[model samples]
Target: MVAEADVSGKEAAALIFTYGTLKRNFSNHPLLQDLILNGDASFIGTYRTVQNYPLVCGPYRVPFLLNIPGSGQSVHGELYSVSTDGLSRMDELEGTSRGHYERLPIKVVPSGEEMEAKITCAEAYYAHGSYAMEMWKKNGKQGLKCYTENETIGYVKRKDRPQHLTFLDHIRLFLSD
Candidate 1:
C-alpha cells in the first residue's frame, strides 16, 4: 500500500530495496541527483540486496526479497525525502500499475534513529522462494558475486565466448532510480 503522508521524514522515510539496476551511476538515477545535492538524503547501509531477472523467473515480477527475512545486511543505497511529485514519478517508473510490483508499507532507518521507521516499500509479487539458489548454480559464485557487488552490472561476460549477452541485454534496462 502507498504510505500516508501523515508520517513525516523524521517519523519515517521511504525505503526502496534495490538489488539490481537501481544503484547509482547505472541508469536514469541521475534524475534523482537532487537528493544528493539537497543534503536531505544519506546512504543507509543496513538492508539486504538481491539480484533477480524477471524474464528468467517470469514476466513483470519483482525479485523476491532475499538476504534478510524482515531486515538484514545493508543494501547499498540512499534515502531521501522526495517531493510527492518525485515519488509519483518513481511509482510510475517502478511500474506500480503492473500487478507484478506494488508499493507496500515498510520501515526505513531514519537518518539518526535507533529503530526503523514506517514507509512505503516496493515489493515483489510472489512468495519468497529458492530462485537465488537456482541463480547461484546457474551462474556460479563469480557471476553471482559480480551481480551482487554492484560492479559491472547490466552485462555479464561469457566464460567461453569471452563476449556475450548480459542482464542488460536480456531485460528492459531500468529507466529510473
Candidate 2:
C-alpha cells in the first residue's frame, strides 16, 4: 500500500528501491537528486528478485526491467526514502501514466548484515503488463537471456567488503590520534 499522510498534514515518506538508471551516478540520477539530498535516505539493502525478470536494453541502449520471473538470479539494488511529491515526479519520468512501468511493493534483505531488522519492504518500478512483453519481444528471448546471464546490466552486485569504513577502522584511527 502507498504510505499515507500523517494526521498533521505531512505525507509519510515513501521507501523506494532502485536497481537501474535511477541509481546514483547513473543517467537518470538527476531526476531524484534533490529528494535524495533533502530526505532521510540510505543504502539499506541488496536483494535478487525471488523470480527472474527481464533486464533488456531499449532504444539508446537504456536498460528496462521486464516483469518476467523465475530466471534464477538475484537482483541487487538500493533503497531510499522519498516524499510524496518526489514519488509523483518519479512516476511521471518512469512513464507510469503510459503504462511503461508500475510501482509495486517488494521484499528485500540486507546482503551482509545478519540482523532481522535489515529485511524490509519497499516499492519499486517494475516493467508492467504489455510494456514488459513488448520489450521482451523486441529484444528477443535469447537477447534477454544473454543480457541477464552474461551482463550485470541493471544489477548492482553486493561487494563482499563493505564500501564504507567499519568501527575497527575508526578505532585504529582514534588510537593513532
Candidate 3:
C-alpha cells in the first residue's frame, strides 16, 4: 500500500522585537518614515520588550539576549508582523549580516502569551579588538537600561552615546570572515 506524505503550512508573518533604535524616537529609527515614504511594512501587537542587549551565542555563531523580564512593568517597544518577502527588506533596513547587527530568535511579552519573535542582535563580528569590544560590551547585567524610570515611551534616554562606526569598518571585519 502507498502511504501519503505529511505537509506543513507556511509561516504566518514574521515578528520582530525592537528595543533600542527601532522603537519610536531612537536616533536611527526610520521605520515610521519608511511606512509613510517607503511603504515597506506595518506593526503588529505580539512582542515583549526586555532590558537587555544582544550577545553572541558560541553554539549558533549568532547573538541572543542575556537578560529579559518575566513579569510586571512593560519594557517599551512595538511588534512588527511583516510579510516573508518583507523580512529581506527589513534585513537591509536593519543592516543584518552586514555587521551592524543581526537577527535572532527571542521570546516576546512578559506573560509568554504570544509566540517568540525575531530581534536585532548586535554582531560579534564587530569584535575586532579592544575598540570593537568597547563598543559591543554591555555593562548592565539585566540588559542596559536605555530609559530612566520617569521617561515615557518613545522618549527614553540612552545611557550612552551612539557610535559612528563606518560601513568600511563593518565591511572589513565581515569580509575577513
Candidate 4:
C-alpha cells in the first residue's frame, strides 16, 4: 500500500529503502526531494535492513550496497513511499537501465528498537551483481552498517568526476592512492 499520495489520485506504488547519496542532504537527494515536493513520494521513516549487506564505497567515493548478505552489517537508511513515476525517475538516476545498480526487494525494520520480529518489505538499489563482488574486494573488503556523510576518505559528486571515464574505470582509479 502507498504510505501517502497526492490529491489527484496519483498514489505511491512502491516502498524504497535509500542508503546512499539519495538520502537527504546527500548529493543526489535533490532528485528525491523533487519527487517529494511534486507529491509523488513521501518519507516513511528510518529503517535498518533485516539482513546484513556490504555497504561499501566505490568510484568517486560513491556508496554501494553490495547484495552479498551475511558479510557486512545490517544497513541503516530511510524509507520512502514512491509513485510509479517517482520510482522510474529514481531508477534512471540510479542507472538501473545501464546496470550500474539494480533494484531489488529487501526486508527492513523501523529503527530505534530492539530488532523487532516484524519486518517490512521494501526495494533498494544495490550494486549490480556482475561487479559488486570485485568492487568490494578492491575496496579492502571493509563495510559499514550506516554510510556516514562525513566519510573519512571524502566524497565526490558526479559532476566533479572525470566525464571521459566510465564508472567502472573510476572504480579502478579510486584506490590507486
- Backbone clash pairs for candidate 3 read 48-109, 51-143, 52-143
Cα lDDT tens digits, model 1, 57-110, are 211222222322332233333333444555555565554564324554344343
Give the distance in Å from residue 140's predicted Cα in candidate 4 to where it truly belongs: 2.6
* Model 3 spans > 4 angstroms off: 1-12, 36-40, 46-75, 110-142, 145-177
**Local accuracy of candidate 2 as per-residue lDDT tens digits, 1-177:** 445433124454667777777776675677667655655233444553433566665543445666666542445666666677677788887768866678887666554444454457777787766555656666655334223323444444223334595423422332344
lDDT to native, each model: 0.36, 0.58, 0.39, 0.83
Query: Model 4 segments beyond 4 Å from truth?
Result: 1-8, 172-177
Error of 4 at 25 (Å): 1.3
In Å, residue 78's CA in model 4 sits off its true spot by 0.3
Give the C-alpha lDDT of model 2: 0.58
- Give all candidate RMSDs, comma-separated: 9.4, 15.3, 10.9, 2.5
Summed over model 4, clashes come to: 0
The local lDDT score (0 to 100) that residue 65 gets in candidate 1 is: 29
Error of 1 at 26 (Å): 1.9
Q: Can you write out model 4's per-residue Cα lDDT over 12-74, one digit (the tens) per residue?
A: 788899998888878888998889888878888899998889999887678999998887898
Clash counts per candidate, in order, are: 4, 6, 3, 0
Order the candidates by lDDT, highest first. Answer: 4, 2, 3, 1
- Give per-residue CA lDDT, model 3, range 1-177, as digits (tens): 001211123232355655544556544356544642443345544344433333322111222233322422344355554444445666665555655455655444532443253443211111223233333333222233333223333332232322464544633453344
